[model samples]
Target: MIKARDALTKIKPYVPGKPIEEVKRELGLDDVIKLASNENPYGPSKKALEIIDSYLTNLNLYPDGRAFELKTALSNYYQVQEEEIIVGNGSDEVIKLLSEAYLNPGDNIVQADVTFSEYEFGALLMGAKVKKVPLKDFTHDLEAFYNYIDDNTKLIYICNPNNPTGTMVTEVELIEFLEKIPKGVLVVLDEAYAEYVADTSYPNSLGLINKYPLVVLRTFSKIYGLAGLRVGFGIAQKEIIANLEKAREPFNVNLLGQVAAVRALDDKEHLEYSFRENAKARESFYQECQKRDIKYVKSHTNFVLMQVEDADTIFNKMLKKGVIVRSGSVFGLNRFIRVTLGSIEQMQRFWQVFDEIGG
Candidate 1:
């Protein structure tokens, strides 16, 4: 066998949430509710769907390599120059591009130990060392990230309203941390669930990009309900975006994704409605957990990480009942499970199944 890179050994395969179809097929059941991936339960805007339908005729042609129209729409929406944004197949690809553009063998990147796994994957793929700082109070310990950084550190990942835990650092805290970052190191803020957050303290990240060596990652996958489209993007200073652009594959984003994302952006009513509904569902989840005497981390994102007796057993039980949720074992939180906030009906189904299994 041909030898693979030594770094490949350090990586673990990512386990995504079970697909609804796959679960139904395997369990021989008709109904399955997926509250696993932190996807928008309320799907994409009708306008987006219409645009996608209209664009079907363009399938034979190639997508705009630079995604000019989509970038223009994003620029207008975010009040940023088009040159500052880099669209990707997904935010995951942009993460890879950042690693390709900056990481080198012997260098290191800093991140929270229990945060998103992709950061570690990207660093390892480029043969860079991953320096993990433990989360403080189920949130990114931004101050601790400073200690992990040294001359060799090239990137720092802060997953705001972090995955799995669903906690976040306040704007005041993040600004203080950003101020202390060294000149050479770049900070990547993965705000994939930013649209779901109702906290007034959330950082207005786009404003900071001009003053700091920072990149803000956003995704249509979550709030815009375009997960199937796989459209995500990064906003940074022109220099950083230029470097990342060099590493970006041509037409990394598909034609349908670009059009859908553009329409999704324009549909402010749909965006507002999704946000409102998510807030309501998240609060209801908290109330339900409290009623059952279940301990849960306060979530700013669309998911809640709740403590369970045995996550693996509960997960399997829930799966058998046609309720799919993420077991916390993947993130090394063996006693917890992360569930997305679904619609009222879906939430009712989840609770019915959960109660039946003694969750």
Candidate 2:
């Protein structure tokens, strides 16, 4: 029998939120509002859907290994050269490619303690040491992270508008932090929820790559409503993107996802509508929390991190009500639960159930 690498032991499989159909079956309820995975409730761009259907009969052909058109679209959108962009199956895969390109048995990676889980997962996959610095006030502590850097630290991930907590590090703060980073280390700015961030304080992360060896990742899964398509891209200086491309598989992204993503890029109307709806819904969540005097981290992304006592029980109860939310024990914040923003009607329904369960 073949032996698997010992590194596999350190990797924990990601747990995705339960699908709507599964909840309906398990809870015996037909009505379900899924607010767990931070999906765009406004749905995908209509233009993207049309392109997907048009490309259906072309499934027999292999996808473009370089994902040329999608990369071109991304380059145009982000104002980066084509050589500096790398499309991946998802930003999750982009993280994995970075790990493959940089990490080794003796190397290490640093990240916020409570941000996206993929950074650690990718580090472990490459036999790299994982160093986690705790958050300061539910936000990335750049000073603490800087302290963690050593010669062995090869990569650092900053999940701006961070996951689960839904907090952020501002542009001014990020610029200061980037200046202090060692020249040998690569910084990955994972801005998976950037479009939802109405905060002017948020950095234009893609532009930062000009001065730093920064890899900025964006995903179609969130604001573009293409989560099911699994399309995401990363932008960096030409050299870094080239290195990542070496680790990326040929045809990493499917043909349909490529065409859909290109069309999605042109759907300005859908982008505006999704952004507006999410902002309005997220604000309503803030009002509900304020009315009940419940503590929650004010979010810049499409989610709210609520501090409810007995979070584990609350999670289960909310699940029974067919309102799916993420319990922060997943990120080691056991007293907090993260709720993804849905449509206004869905948010209203969630509050109705939330009020019944003592807020």
Candidate 3:
């Protein structure tokens, strides 16, 4: 019998949140709420839906491989050169592209232990080794990250407002870390939830593109509520962008995604509304945790990572109660869970059920 490469053994697949329909059917219940996966609970901006509806007729044609119009829009929005932008099916594609383009077997990728799992996934696909550095106090320890880099280190992933922890590395610390890293090593700063950051100290990662050989990734999946549409992009130096583009499929991003993302960028009102609601919900949730004496990391982004004894049990209980949050076991934090801050009403409902369970 044929067998796969040895590296396949190192790869653990990503398990996303179950669909609400699947959950309801399994539990035989109705009115399920999913706060898992950090999806925007407000749903997509109306303008995005309207534009996508208008573009439905064009679905028969292949999407623009270059994604020129969307890239142009992104360039104007971020004040970056058009050549520096590359659109993807989502940031997941971008991550895969970076690994494919840069990593060689036996090379190394580095990230905090309990952060987004994709960085290690990308490494394993390319037969590279992952050096897991433990986070400091639920945040990325910039010093440890820099210390881990060596001649064999090809990639270092910084998930700002990190997944499962909902904590961030500040701008000053990131700038210093970037400066200290070797020029040959690529820094992929995955700012997937950046739009929800209310903190003034989070690095403006795009600004670093011109100064260093860094790639800053963003997604419409979060605040723009386009996760279902699968739109995300990366900003890097022209040389680095060219390398990643080589690994990209001819039409990785679909027609609907381009249309939706363009309209979503223009919907400033929707953007502001989502940000405001997320900030408020984050505060309220923190207060709830405080009152209950539940330990949680203070978040600048749209989610909270709270410690509960037997998170698996609490997660199962919440599921049965028609609410769903992410168990942190996937990120190697078995005692914690990540809850996405949703609309005021949805958040209130989540807390209500949570109180009942914890009480």
Candidate 4:
């Protein structure tokens, strides 16, 4: 038998929601609506499909290692220097690269206890410790996060509009937290669902890059509707980007992803369309929760976390009904369930099944 690193001892496998095809196959259902992963219900933009179709004939050739064209497009879009960006297979890879670059056996990362699991997974991969801060009022407690920092801390993660809960910290609180952090600690503002946020008070993470040693990560997977293509990028100072680039694999993002992402960035109409529709659907979900007198966390992301009785049972029941949602046990909150807000017809079907089953 081979010996693995001690770090593997502390890690648990990351569980994703059941896929639509698998559910359909197992349950023998023709129509399966998945609100489990916060994916865009409308699917990819037409422009991205056109771009991908053009690139399909060139599959035999290796992708451009530098990703020069996509990087240039992102530079122009975000008003940042080309050298200030690092694109990855997904934002998940960049997080792993950061951990590889900075974390050591004793170094630690600080994040909310119930936020994104990737932070802990990345840290543990490099044998780094994790200090988990409890969320106050179902949102990131900035004060508590500040207090958790110490000399051994190497990275800090704030998943704005955090996963599972979908709640966020305001702009003022974020600025204050960034201002007081000790030098040398890298802060990652994970805004995976930033496009769904309708709140004007959400922090402008890009504007703070010049002032702090941090990275702003955004994904094409959410509102951009390109999750299957697997493209996400990070914005930071040139120096931070340089360090991360050293650890990035060549052609980490495929040819199709680069083309699709560039095309997606240019399609503002598609972006806004998904945004407006998601906002409308999310509100309807909120109203349904209200009408049913169910307690739910106000969400800036596309998912809502609702406290329920026997979440695992309700989760299985929803799955059996061909409407798949996430059970809160995946996030350490066994009495709650997280449901993604989807299209009006999808949401209506979900609620119809849920109404019958009684969550």
Candidate 5:
């Protein structure tokens, strides 16, 4: 019999949002609303879906291992070279590749205490330690992060418009923080929710990737509405891409995901529509919170983290009412709950049940 590695014991697998069908079955309700994962409630661009449908007959062929067409499309859109881009199965895979390429035993990765869990899991998988600096006032504390860096720090993960909290580090703060860090340490800026950001204060992370030797991860999963296709890409210096390439499995991304991502990039109208809808609904959500006298964090992304005492109780209650929102206890923030912003009608429905429950 074989046992798992000691490092594997330190890692906990990620738990994604439950499917709507599962919730409906569990609660015995027909009107279930899922606002847990920050999925684009509008769904994918019709053109992208059509393109994917057209390519289904060719599933017998292996995917373009290099994802040439998709890389070229992303390169053209971002004004970066194709050589500087590396497409991933998802941005999740890119994080794992970065850890595989850079971390050695006992090295450390630094990130905010309650940001995305994948970064910590990536480091732990590589037999490395994670140094998490606590967030300040529900936001990334750049000064605190800078203070904690040491010689053994191999990477720093910055999730702009951070997960769970939906708070962002400002452009000014990010620029100053970048300048203070040394060259050898790679900064992985995860902007999976960047497209939903309406706040001008958020950092222009792509610009930093060009200026410094940083890696910027973006995904088709959010505003592009391609999460089911599992498409995402990273932009970095040519050397960084070359290093990460060593860890990638050829044909890691599927043919359908590549085709969908390429077409989605061309659908400017769909992209704009998602942006506008998220911004509008976010304001309404904030107003609803105000009306209820509930304390909530103002968000730059497509989700809001609202504070509630007995969050577990509220989560279970919401589920019983056919609404699925995330309980933040997994991130160790027991007092907070994260809800994805949706269309006006969907969000209005959420608040309706919220009001009925006297929450």
Candidate 6:
């Protein structure tokens, strides 16, 4: 076999949630509800769907390499200059781009131990060291993150309303943390689930971009329901964006994705409805967990991490019953399972299956 880069030895492949079709095929089930991935069950806006057909004829040509139209839309919406934004295949790609542009061997990145895995993956891929700070109260310990940074630290990833645990750092807390970060170190605020947060204290990360060496990542996947389209973007100071752009793949966002994302941004009704419904479903899940005396971390995102007697067993039981939830073992939280809050009807089905499994 050809010799691979030594960095591959340090990296573990990301295991995504089982798809609904894959579950049905493997288990011989007719129906399955997937709450494993934190995807918008409601799907994309009608306006976005309407524009897809019109873009079909142009598939023979490559998409605009810069994703000009979508960037313009985002610029108008966020009130940032077009030069300050970088569109990617997904925010996931933007993470990789940042790593490629900055990380070098012996350099290090700091992030919450149990937060999003991509931050670590990116660093490891570049042969950079990862310094993990344990979460305090299931939330990012900003103070501890500051302590982890030294001259070798090149990046810091803060997942607002962090993945798996769904916990958040307040605006005041984040601002304080940013103020303490050393100059030349880039702070990446991954806010993929920002639209789902009902908390008034969630930081306006976009507003802080100009003041700090910050990149705020947002996606059309969750709130705009364009996960399948694979459209995500990052907003930052033009200099930072220019550097990341150098490492980005040309035409990373597909043509249809660009058109759909632009139209999705215009669908205010769909955006509002999705946000309102997610809040309701999240609250309902919280009540259900409380009534059963199930321990759960309070969430700001559209998912909840609940403690169970045996998460692996519970996950398998739920899987067999046509419900797919993410076992927290992957994040090193062996006793918990992270479940995405679905629509009212889908969540009802989740509860029905969960109860049948004696969970």
lDDT top scorer? 1
Worst 10 residues of 6 by lDDT: 350-359
How much does candidate 6 score in TM-score? 0.99
- Cα lDDT tens digits, model 6, 1-359, are 99999999999999898899999999999989999889988888999999998889999999999899999999999999999999999899999999999999999999998989999999999999999999999999999888899999999999998998899999999999988899879999999999998888889998899899999999988889899999999999999999999998888999999999999999999999999998899889989999999999999888999999888999999999999999998999899999999988889998898889899
RMSD of each: 0.8, 1.2, 1.1, 0.9, 1.2, 0.8
Total clashes for model 2: 0
Candidate 4: deviation at residue 30, Å? Answer: 2.3
Per-model lDDT: 0.94, 0.90, 0.90, 0.92, 0.90, 0.93
CA lDDT, candidate 4, residue 347: 92
lDDT of 1 by residue, 205-293 (tens): 99999998999999999999999999999999999999999998897999999999999999999999999999999889999999999
lDDT of 4: 0.92
Q: Where does candidate 3 have its weakest 10-residue lDDT segment?
A: 325-334
lDDT of 3 by residue, 259-289 (tens): 8899999999999999988888888998888
Winner on TM-score (5 vs 6): 6
Report clashes for each candidate as comma-separated counts: 0, 0, 0, 0, 0, 0
Better structure of 1 and 3 per TM-score: 1
What shift in Å separates residue 204 of candidate 6 from its native position after superposition? Answer: 1.0
lDDT of 2 by residue, 1-359 (tens): 79899999888888877789999998899888899999999899999999999999999999999888998888887788999999999899999999999999979999998889989999999899999999999999998998899999999999988998889999999999999998899999999999988888899887788899899999999999999989998999999999999999998999989999999999999999999988888788888888999999989889899998977778888889889888877878889889999888888888889888875
What is the model-wide C-alpha lDDT for candidate 2?
0.90
Weakest 10 consecutive residues, lDDT, candidate 5? 204-213
Better of 1 and 6 by lDDT: 1
> Model 5, 1-359: lDDT tens per residue?
69989999997878877779999898799988889989999999998999999999999999999999999999899999998999999999999999999999999999998999899989999999999999998888989998878999999999988998888888898899889898689998999998887777878777777687689999999999999889888999999999999999999999999999999999999999999988888888898889878999988889999988867877888888988899888788888889999888889888887777766
Model 3 alpha-carbon drift over 4 Å, by segment: none
